[model samples]
Target: MLTMKNVTKVFRTEMVETHALRELTLEVKSGEFVAVTGPSGSGKTTFLNIAGLLDDFTGGEYRLDGVEVRQLGDRARSKLRNEKIGFVFQSFNLIPDLNLFDNVDVPLRYRGFTRGERRQRIERALERVGLASRIRHFPAELSGGQQQRVAIARAIAGDPKLLLADEPTGNLDSQMAREVMQLLEELNAGGTVVVIVTHDPEIAARAQRNVHIVDGVASHLDRGPALVSPALRTA
Candidate 1:
Protein backbone atom coordinates (compact mmCIF):
# COMPACT_ATOMS: atom_id res chain seq x y z
CA MET A 1 0.00 0.00 0.00
CA LEU A 2 3.02 2.24 0.61
CA THR A 3 6.13 2.28 -1.56
CA MET A 4 9.32 4.28 -1.44
CA LYS A 5 12.14 4.12 -3.97
CA ASN A 6 15.53 5.72 -3.49
CA VAL A 7 14.09 8.16 -0.96
CA THR A 8 16.61 10.80 0.06
CA LYS A 9 16.18 13.69 2.48
CA VAL A 10 18.82 16.37 2.61
CA PHE A 11 19.07 19.39 4.84
CA ARG A 12 21.37 21.98 3.31
CA THR A 13 22.81 25.14 4.78
CA GLU A 14 25.44 27.49 3.37
CA MET A 15 28.00 25.88 5.66
CA VAL A 16 27.08 22.21 5.44
CA GLU A 17 24.71 19.63 4.00
CA THR A 18 23.18 16.95 6.18
CA HIS A 19 21.68 13.86 4.69
CA ALA A 20 19.01 12.46 6.99
CA LEU A 21 17.92 9.73 4.59
CA ARG A 22 19.92 8.24 1.74
CA GLU A 23 18.19 6.26 -0.92
CA LEU A 24 15.85 4.63 1.59
CA THR A 25 13.60 2.08 -0.05
CA LEU A 26 10.83 0.11 1.61
CA GLU A 27 7.32 -1.18 1.05
CA VAL A 28 4.48 -1.71 3.47
CA LYS A 29 1.54 -3.71 2.20
CA SER A 30 -2.10 -3.62 3.29
CA GLY A 31 -2.82 -5.28 6.64
CA GLU A 32 0.86 -5.47 7.56
CA PHE A 33 2.14 -4.62 11.03
CA VAL A 34 5.74 -3.49 10.54
CA ALA A 35 8.08 -2.15 13.17
CA VAL A 36 10.81 0.29 12.22
CA THR A 37 13.72 0.11 14.68
CA GLY A 38 16.78 2.25 14.51
CA PRO A 39 19.28 3.98 16.72
CA SER A 40 19.45 7.72 17.18
CA GLY A 41 20.47 9.65 14.08
CA SER A 42 19.43 6.70 11.94
CA GLY A 43 16.61 8.60 10.22
CA LYS A 44 13.61 6.73 11.61
CA THR A 45 11.69 9.92 12.37
CA THR A 46 12.60 11.35 8.98
CA PHE A 47 11.23 8.25 7.30
CA LEU A 48 8.03 8.41 9.34
CA ASN A 49 7.52 12.09 8.53
CA ILE A 50 7.99 11.45 4.84
CA ALA A 51 5.79 8.38 4.88
CA GLY A 52 2.99 10.28 6.61
CA LEU A 53 3.35 13.23 4.20
CA LEU A 54 4.39 15.56 7.02
CA ASP A 55 7.63 16.35 5.20
CA ASP A 56 8.83 16.09 1.64
CA PHE A 57 11.90 14.15 0.66
CA THR A 58 14.71 15.88 -1.19
CA GLY A 59 14.80 13.14 -3.82
CA GLY A 60 13.25 9.80 -4.76
CA GLU A 61 9.65 8.68 -5.22
CA TYR A 62 6.88 7.87 -2.75
CA ARG A 63 3.54 6.44 -3.74
CA LEU A 64 0.82 6.27 -1.15
CA ASP A 65 -2.05 3.97 -2.04
CA GLY A 66 -1.12 4.36 -5.72
CA VAL A 67 -0.83 8.17 -5.68
CA GLU A 68 2.63 9.63 -6.27
CA VAL A 69 3.00 12.10 -3.42
CA ARG A 70 5.86 14.05 -4.99
CA GLN A 71 3.59 15.52 -7.64
CA LEU A 72 0.93 16.76 -5.22
CA GLY A 73 0.69 20.31 -3.93
CA ASP A 74 0.61 21.11 -0.24
CA ARG A 75 -3.17 21.34 -0.11
CA ALA A 76 -3.58 18.03 -1.85
CA ARG A 77 -0.99 16.41 0.41
CA SER A 78 -2.77 17.73 3.49
CA LYS A 79 -6.09 16.42 2.26
CA LEU A 80 -4.68 13.01 1.44
CA ARG A 81 -2.88 12.79 4.78
CA ASN A 82 -6.00 13.65 6.71
CA GLU A 83 -8.00 11.16 4.70
CA LYS A 84 -5.57 8.25 4.61
CA ILE A 85 -3.07 8.37 7.49
CA GLY A 86 -3.47 8.24 11.27
CA PHE A 87 -0.69 9.02 13.73
CA VAL A 88 0.00 8.04 17.34
CA PHE A 89 2.82 9.92 18.97
CA GLN A 90 5.13 9.07 21.85
CA SER A 91 3.83 12.00 23.80
CA PHE A 92 0.09 11.90 23.79
CA ASN A 93 -0.60 15.11 21.88
CA LEU A 94 -3.98 15.61 23.51
CA ILE A 95 -5.24 19.10 24.15
CA PRO A 96 -4.80 19.71 27.84
CA ASP A 97 -8.05 21.61 28.24
CA LEU A 98 -10.27 19.44 26.08
CA ASN A 99 -12.04 16.45 27.51
CA LEU A 100 -11.68 13.02 25.92
CA PHE A 101 -14.70 13.37 23.62
CA ASP A 102 -13.70 16.82 22.40
CA ASN A 103 -10.12 15.75 21.82
CA VAL A 104 -11.25 12.92 19.61
CA ASP A 105 -13.75 15.24 17.92
CA VAL A 106 -11.18 17.87 16.93
CA PRO A 107 -9.88 16.16 13.77
CA LEU A 108 -13.32 15.01 12.73
CA ARG A 109 -14.41 18.62 12.90
CA TYR A 110 -11.75 19.51 10.32
CA ARG A 111 -13.06 16.78 8.01
CA GLY A 112 -16.34 18.74 7.73
CA PHE A 113 -18.44 15.87 8.91
CA THR A 114 -21.90 16.68 10.21
CA ARG A 115 -22.22 17.16 13.95
CA GLY A 116 -23.96 13.82 14.34
CA GLU A 117 -21.33 12.07 12.30
CA ARG A 118 -18.52 13.61 14.31
CA ARG A 119 -20.19 12.62 17.55
CA GLN A 120 -20.73 9.09 16.32
CA ARG A 121 -17.12 8.79 15.17
CA ILE A 122 -15.80 10.12 18.46
CA GLU A 123 -17.86 7.70 20.52
CA ARG A 124 -17.01 4.75 18.32
CA ALA A 125 -13.34 5.57 18.34
CA LEU A 126 -13.27 5.86 22.08
CA GLU A 127 -15.25 2.65 22.35
CA ARG A 128 -12.70 0.85 20.24
CA VAL A 129 -9.99 2.06 22.60
CA GLY A 130 -12.09 0.97 25.59
CA LEU A 131 -12.63 4.52 26.78
CA ALA A 132 -16.30 5.10 25.98
CA SER A 133 -17.28 5.68 29.58
CA ARG A 134 -14.56 8.26 30.08
CA ILE A 135 -15.67 10.53 27.31
CA ARG A 136 -16.13 13.38 29.75
CA HIS A 137 -12.87 12.82 31.58
CA PHE A 138 -9.97 15.15 31.10
CA PRO A 139 -6.49 13.97 30.07
CA ALA A 140 -5.02 14.96 33.44
CA GLU A 141 -7.43 12.61 35.16
CA LEU A 142 -6.34 9.52 33.24
CA SER A 143 -3.26 7.34 33.65
CA GLY A 144 -0.48 7.49 31.10
CA GLY A 145 -1.85 4.47 29.29
CA GLN A 146 -5.36 5.90 29.24
CA GLN A 147 -4.07 9.15 27.85
CA GLN A 148 -2.24 7.23 25.11
CA ARG A 149 -5.43 5.40 24.31
CA VAL A 150 -7.12 8.74 23.87
CA ALA A 151 -4.41 9.69 21.41
CA ILE A 152 -4.96 6.47 19.53
CA ALA A 153 -8.69 7.13 19.53
CA ARG A 154 -8.13 10.57 18.07
CA ALA A 155 -5.95 9.02 15.38
CA ILE A 156 -8.31 6.23 14.35
CA ALA A 157 -11.50 8.31 14.39
CA GLY A 158 -11.03 9.02 10.70
CA ASP A 159 -10.88 5.32 9.80
CA PRO A 160 -7.55 5.83 8.09
CA LYS A 161 -6.02 3.38 5.64
CA LEU A 162 -2.60 3.57 7.30
CA LEU A 163 -1.65 3.94 10.96
CA LEU A 164 1.75 5.38 11.93
CA ALA A 165 2.77 5.12 15.56
CA ASP A 166 6.00 6.52 17.01
CA GLU A 167 7.13 5.20 20.37
CA PRO A 168 3.50 4.51 21.20
CA THR A 169 4.14 2.79 24.52
CA GLY A 170 7.16 4.75 25.64
CA ASN A 171 5.44 6.35 28.63
CA LEU A 172 3.42 3.46 29.97
CA ASP A 173 4.20 0.70 32.45
CA SER A 174 4.81 -2.80 31.19
CA GLN A 175 1.25 -3.97 31.64
CA MET A 176 -0.13 -0.84 30.06
CA ALA A 177 2.33 -1.17 27.22
CA ARG A 178 1.14 -4.69 26.62
CA GLU A 179 -2.44 -3.52 26.63
CA VAL A 180 -1.69 -0.79 24.11
CA MET A 181 0.22 -3.21 21.91
CA GLN A 182 -2.70 -5.59 21.98
CA LEU A 183 -4.99 -2.80 20.84
CA LEU A 184 -2.65 -1.97 17.94
CA GLU A 185 -2.51 -5.64 17.01
CA GLU A 186 -6.27 -5.78 16.98
CA LEU A 187 -6.43 -2.80 14.65
CA ASN A 188 -3.84 -4.33 12.31
CA ALA A 189 -5.82 -7.56 12.26
CA GLY A 190 -8.81 -5.52 11.15
CA GLY A 191 -6.79 -4.47 8.05
CA THR A 192 -5.26 -1.04 8.72
CA VAL A 193 -1.64 -0.90 7.55
CA VAL A 194 0.39 -0.29 10.73
CA VAL A 195 3.95 1.00 10.70
CA ILE A 196 5.47 1.62 14.10
CA VAL A 197 8.80 3.31 14.79
CA THR A 198 10.24 2.27 18.12
CA HIS A 199 13.49 1.57 20.00
CA ASP A 200 12.23 -1.02 22.42
CA PRO A 201 13.20 -4.57 21.48
CA GLU A 202 10.18 -6.13 23.19
CA ILE A 203 7.89 -3.85 21.30
CA ALA A 204 9.64 -4.61 18.01
CA ALA A 205 9.37 -8.32 18.63
CA ARG A 206 5.58 -8.14 18.67
CA ALA A 207 5.21 -6.88 15.15
CA GLN A 208 4.59 -9.13 12.14
CA ARG A 209 7.79 -7.89 10.49
CA ASN A 210 10.81 -5.79 11.37
CA VAL A 211 12.59 -3.16 9.33
CA HIS A 212 15.84 -1.84 10.73
CA ILE A 213 17.31 1.41 9.47
CA VAL A 214 20.91 2.54 9.61
CA ASP A 215 22.78 5.31 7.90
CA GLY A 216 19.43 6.57 6.58
CA VAL A 217 18.53 3.36 4.76
CA ALA A 218 16.75 0.10 5.40
CA SER A 219 19.48 -2.29 6.51
CA HIS A 220 17.43 -5.28 7.58
CA LEU A 221 13.98 -6.65 6.92
CA ASP A 222 12.41 -9.87 8.10
CA ARG A 223 11.25 -11.78 5.03
CA GLY A 224 9.38 -14.56 6.78
CA PRO A 225 5.63 -14.89 6.85
CA ALA A 226 3.58 -12.72 9.20
CA LEU A 227 4.56 -13.26 12.81
CA VAL A 228 1.44 -12.65 14.85
CA SER A 229 0.78 -13.89 18.35
CA PRO A 230 -0.37 -17.49 18.18
CA ALA A 231 -3.50 -16.71 20.19
CA LEU A 232 -4.53 -14.18 17.56
CA ARG A 233 -4.17 -16.75 14.79
CA THR A 234 -7.23 -18.67 16.03
CA ALA A 235 -9.22 -15.61 16.95
Candidate 2:
Protein backbone atom coordinates (compact mmCIF):
# COMPACT_ATOMS: atom_id res chain seq x y z
CA MET A 1 0.00 0.00 0.00
CA LEU A 2 1.30 3.43 -1.03
CA THR A 3 -0.49 6.68 -0.31
CA MET A 4 0.33 10.30 -0.99
CA LYS A 5 -1.88 12.97 0.50
CA ASN A 6 -1.68 16.50 -0.89
CA VAL A 7 2.00 16.13 -1.72
CA THR A 8 4.12 19.00 -3.03
CA LYS A 9 7.66 19.19 -4.36
CA VAL A 10 9.46 22.43 -5.14
CA PHE A 11 12.82 23.04 -6.71
CA ARG A 12 14.50 26.27 -5.73
CA THR A 13 17.49 28.16 -6.98
CA GLU A 14 18.73 31.67 -6.38
CA MET A 15 16.90 32.86 -9.47
CA VAL A 16 13.59 31.03 -9.33
CA GLU A 17 11.41 28.44 -7.62
CA THR A 18 9.74 25.72 -9.65
CA HIS A 19 6.97 23.51 -8.47
CA ALA A 20 7.32 19.96 -9.79
CA LEU A 21 4.32 18.61 -7.91
CA ARG A 22 1.39 20.50 -6.46
CA GLU A 23 -0.92 18.89 -3.98
CA LEU A 24 -0.74 15.58 -5.81
CA THR A 25 -2.69 12.85 -4.11
CA LEU A 26 -2.84 9.19 -5.13
CA GLU A 27 -3.27 5.81 -3.52
CA VAL A 28 -2.21 2.32 -4.69
CA LYS A 29 -3.62 -0.61 -2.82
CA SER A 30 -1.86 -3.90 -2.26
CA GLY A 31 -2.35 -6.52 -5.00
CA GLU A 32 -3.11 -3.80 -7.53
CA PHE A 33 -1.45 -3.18 -10.89
CA VAL A 34 -1.38 0.55 -11.65
CA ALA A 35 -0.12 2.59 -14.56
CA VAL A 36 0.91 6.25 -14.25
CA THR A 37 0.92 8.22 -17.50
CA GLY A 38 1.62 11.86 -18.32
CA PRO A 39 3.11 14.16 -20.89
CA SER A 40 6.69 15.32 -20.84
CA GLY A 41 7.53 17.75 -18.04
CA SER A 42 4.28 16.85 -16.30
CA GLY A 43 6.10 15.92 -13.06
CA LYS A 44 6.10 12.21 -13.82
CA THR A 45 9.77 11.84 -13.01
CA THR A 46 9.36 13.90 -9.89
CA PHE A 47 6.45 11.78 -8.78
CA LEU A 48 8.35 8.56 -9.47
CA ASN A 49 11.36 9.78 -7.49
CA ILE A 50 9.24 10.75 -4.53
CA ALA A 51 7.18 7.60 -4.69
CA GLY A 52 10.24 5.33 -4.80
CA LEU A 53 11.75 7.14 -1.80
CA LEU A 54 14.62 8.42 -3.94
CA ASP A 55 13.70 12.04 -3.14
CA ASP A 56 11.75 13.96 -0.53
CA PHE A 57 8.61 16.02 -1.00
CA THR A 58 8.61 19.60 0.19
CA GLY A 59 5.20 19.21 1.81
CA GLY A 60 2.37 16.76 2.55
CA GLU A 61 2.30 13.20 3.74
CA TYR A 62 3.63 9.95 2.25
CA ARG A 63 2.94 6.58 3.79
CA LEU A 64 4.34 3.26 2.54
CA ASP A 65 2.82 0.15 4.04
CA GLY A 66 1.22 2.48 6.61
CA VAL A 67 4.51 4.03 7.78
CA GLU A 68 4.93 7.77 7.29
CA VAL A 69 8.16 8.61 5.42
CA ARG A 70 8.64 12.35 5.80
CA GLN A 71 10.31 12.00 9.19
CA LEU A 72 12.61 9.07 8.45
CA GLY A 73 16.36 9.67 8.34
CA ASP A 74 18.48 8.71 5.35
CA ARG A 75 19.50 5.33 6.71
CA ALA A 76 16.03 4.49 7.85
CA ARG A 77 14.64 5.53 4.49
CA SER A 78 17.16 3.32 2.66
CA LYS A 79 16.33 0.41 4.90
CA LEU A 80 12.62 0.81 4.34
CA ARG A 81 13.07 1.18 0.59
CA ASN A 82 15.27 -1.91 0.33
CA GLU A 83 12.91 -3.99 2.41
CA LYS A 84 9.63 -2.84 0.84
CA ILE A 85 10.17 -1.34 -2.63
CA GLY A 86 11.89 -2.70 -5.75
CA PHE A 87 12.78 -0.37 -8.61
CA VAL A 88 13.09 -1.06 -12.34
CA PHE A 89 14.21 1.66 -14.69
CA GLN A 90 14.26 2.48 -18.43
CA SER A 91 17.98 2.06 -18.86
CA PHE A 92 18.07 -1.38 -17.21
CA ASN A 93 21.06 -0.05 -15.18
CA LEU A 94 22.99 -3.27 -15.32
CA ILE A 95 26.71 -3.06 -14.82
CA PRO A 96 28.32 -3.89 -18.14
CA ASP A 97 31.15 -5.78 -16.56
CA LEU A 98 29.04 -7.93 -14.26
CA ASN A 99 27.37 -11.16 -15.28
CA LEU A 100 23.65 -11.65 -14.67
CA PHE A 101 24.20 -13.48 -11.42
CA ASP A 102 26.52 -10.85 -10.00
CA ASN A 103 24.27 -8.07 -11.26
CA VAL A 104 21.33 -9.43 -9.28
CA ASP A 105 23.61 -10.20 -6.36
CA VAL A 106 24.59 -6.53 -5.87
CA PRO A 107 21.59 -5.27 -3.89
CA LEU A 108 21.21 -8.44 -1.90
CA ARG A 109 24.75 -7.96 -0.66
CA TYR A 110 23.68 -4.60 0.74
CA ARG A 111 20.96 -6.33 2.73
CA GLY A 112 23.77 -8.21 4.55
CA PHE A 113 22.42 -11.58 3.53
CA THR A 114 24.88 -14.40 4.13
CA ARG A 115 26.81 -15.71 1.13
CA GLY A 116 24.60 -18.79 0.75
CA GLU A 117 21.44 -16.70 1.19
CA ARG A 118 22.49 -14.25 -1.48
CA ARG A 119 23.24 -17.15 -3.80
CA GLN A 120 19.80 -18.59 -3.14
CA ARG A 121 18.06 -15.28 -3.80
CA ILE A 122 20.09 -14.54 -6.94
CA GLU A 123 19.35 -17.97 -8.37
CA ARG A 124 15.67 -17.81 -7.44
CA ALA A 125 15.20 -14.35 -8.92
CA LEU A 126 17.00 -15.27 -12.12
CA GLU A 127 14.96 -18.44 -12.39
CA ARG A 128 11.80 -16.43 -11.96
CA VAL A 129 12.70 -14.27 -14.97
CA GLY A 130 13.71 -17.31 -17.04
CA LEU A 131 17.31 -16.20 -17.10
CA ALA A 132 18.85 -18.78 -14.80
CA SER A 133 20.51 -20.46 -17.78
CA ARG A 134 22.25 -17.19 -18.65
CA ILE A 135 23.41 -16.37 -15.16
CA ARG A 136 27.02 -16.29 -16.31
CA HIS A 137 26.33 -14.13 -19.38
CA PHE A 138 27.20 -10.45 -19.42
CA PRO A 139 24.60 -7.80 -20.24
CA ALA A 140 26.36 -6.93 -23.50
CA GLU A 141 25.89 -10.47 -24.73
CA LEU A 142 22.12 -10.57 -24.26
CA SER A 143 19.35 -8.96 -26.30
CA GLY A 144 17.46 -5.93 -25.01
CA GLY A 145 14.54 -8.00 -23.71
CA GLN A 146 16.89 -10.35 -21.94
CA GLN A 147 18.69 -7.44 -20.32
CA GLN A 148 15.37 -6.03 -19.15
CA ARG A 149 14.50 -9.40 -17.68
CA VAL A 150 17.77 -9.31 -15.81
CA ALA A 151 16.78 -5.89 -14.46
CA ILE A 152 13.42 -7.23 -13.37
CA ALA A 153 15.10 -10.18 -11.70
CA ARG A 154 17.39 -7.84 -9.80
CA ALA A 155 14.41 -5.76 -8.67
CA ILE A 156 12.54 -8.81 -7.37
CA ALA A 157 15.58 -10.41 -5.79
CA GLY A 158 14.89 -8.51 -2.59
CA ASP A 159 11.36 -9.91 -2.41
CA PRO A 160 9.90 -6.42 -2.17
CA LYS A 161 6.21 -5.82 -1.71
CA LEU A 162 6.11 -2.85 -4.10
CA LEU A 163 7.58 -2.90 -7.62
CA LEU A 164 8.09 0.53 -9.16
CA ALA A 165 8.96 0.53 -12.87
CA ASP A 166 9.92 3.66 -14.81
CA GLU A 167 9.58 3.39 -18.61
CA PRO A 168 10.51 -0.26 -18.38
CA THR A 169 9.82 -1.02 -22.01
CA GLY A 170 10.87 2.27 -23.55
CA ASN A 171 13.96 0.83 -25.20
CA LEU A 172 12.54 -2.40 -26.49
CA ASP A 173 10.88 -3.21 -29.79
CA SER A 174 7.19 -4.09 -29.94
CA GLN A 175 7.71 -7.81 -29.56
CA MET A 176 10.14 -7.42 -26.70
CA ALA A 177 7.87 -4.88 -25.08
CA ARG A 178 4.98 -7.30 -25.18
CA GLU A 179 7.12 -10.00 -23.65
CA VAL A 180 8.14 -7.70 -20.82
CA MET A 181 4.57 -6.63 -20.22
CA GLN A 182 3.50 -10.26 -20.06
CA LEU A 183 6.17 -10.91 -17.47
CA LEU A 184 4.99 -7.91 -15.47
CA GLU A 185 1.41 -9.13 -15.67
CA GLU A 186 2.50 -12.52 -14.40
CA LEU A 187 4.29 -10.86 -11.50
CA ASN A 188 1.21 -8.80 -10.74
CA ALA A 189 -0.89 -11.96 -10.85
CA GLY A 190 1.31 -13.33 -8.12
CA GLY A 191 0.20 -10.39 -5.88
CA THR A 192 3.11 -7.94 -6.10
CA VAL A 193 1.94 -4.33 -6.05
CA VAL A 194 3.04 -3.18 -9.53
CA VAL A 195 3.22 0.52 -10.37
CA ILE A 196 4.49 1.35 -13.85
CA VAL A 197 5.31 4.81 -15.20
CA THR A 198 5.01 4.79 -18.98
CA HIS A 199 4.16 6.96 -21.97
CA ASP A 200 2.84 4.11 -24.11
CA PRO A 201 -0.92 3.78 -24.09
CA GLU A 202 -0.81 0.10 -25.06
CA ILE A 203 1.32 -0.58 -22.02
CA ALA A 204 -0.77 1.63 -19.77
CA ALA A 205 -4.01 0.07 -20.99
CA ARG A 206 -3.00 -3.29 -19.59
CA ALA A 207 -3.08 -2.07 -16.01
CA GLN A 208 -6.21 -2.52 -13.91
CA ARG A 209 -6.12 1.21 -13.03
CA ASN A 210 -4.58 4.21 -14.71
CA VAL A 211 -3.64 7.53 -13.12
CA HIS A 212 -2.92 10.39 -15.46
CA ILE A 213 -0.92 13.38 -14.32
CA VAL A 214 -0.92 16.88 -15.78
CA ASP A 215 0.84 19.92 -14.39
CA GLY A 216 1.42 18.02 -11.14
CA VAL A 217 -2.23 17.07 -10.58
CA ALA A 218 -3.43 13.48 -10.94
CA SER A 219 -6.72 12.04 -12.20
CA HIS A 220 -7.92 8.48 -12.05
CA LEU A 221 -9.02 6.75 -15.24
CA ASP A 222 -9.99 3.37 -13.93
CA ARG A 223 -10.21 0.54 -16.44
CA GLY A 224 -12.88 -2.13 -16.66
CA PRO A 225 -13.04 -5.65 -15.22
CA ALA A 226 -11.37 -7.04 -18.33
CA LEU A 227 -8.09 -5.65 -17.10
CA VAL A 228 -8.46 -7.08 -13.61
CA SER A 229 -6.56 -10.29 -12.83
CA PRO A 230 -8.36 -13.55 -12.04
CA ALA A 231 -7.29 -13.38 -8.39
CA LEU A 232 -8.59 -9.82 -8.10
CA ARG A 233 -11.85 -10.74 -9.83
CA THR A 234 -12.33 -13.62 -7.42
CA ALA A 235 -11.44 -11.41 -4.45
Q: What is the TM-score of each candidate against the true structure?
A: 0.93, 0.94
Q: Cα RMSD (Å) per model?
A: 2.8, 3.7
Name the Cα RMSD for model 1: 2.8
TM-score of 1: 0.93
Clashes of 1: 0
Candidate of highest TM-score: 2
For model 2, where is the 10-residue window of minimal lDDT?
226-235
Per-residue alpha-carbon lDDT of candidate 2 for residues 156-202, written as tens digits (9 for 90 to 100): 99989999999999999877777788888888998899999987776
True lDDT of residue 14, candidate 1: 100
Record all residue pairs in model 1 with backbone atoms less than 3 Å apart, i.e. clashing. Answer: none
Candidate number with greatest lDDT: 2
lDDT of 1 at 151: 94
The lDDT per prediction is: 0.90, 0.90
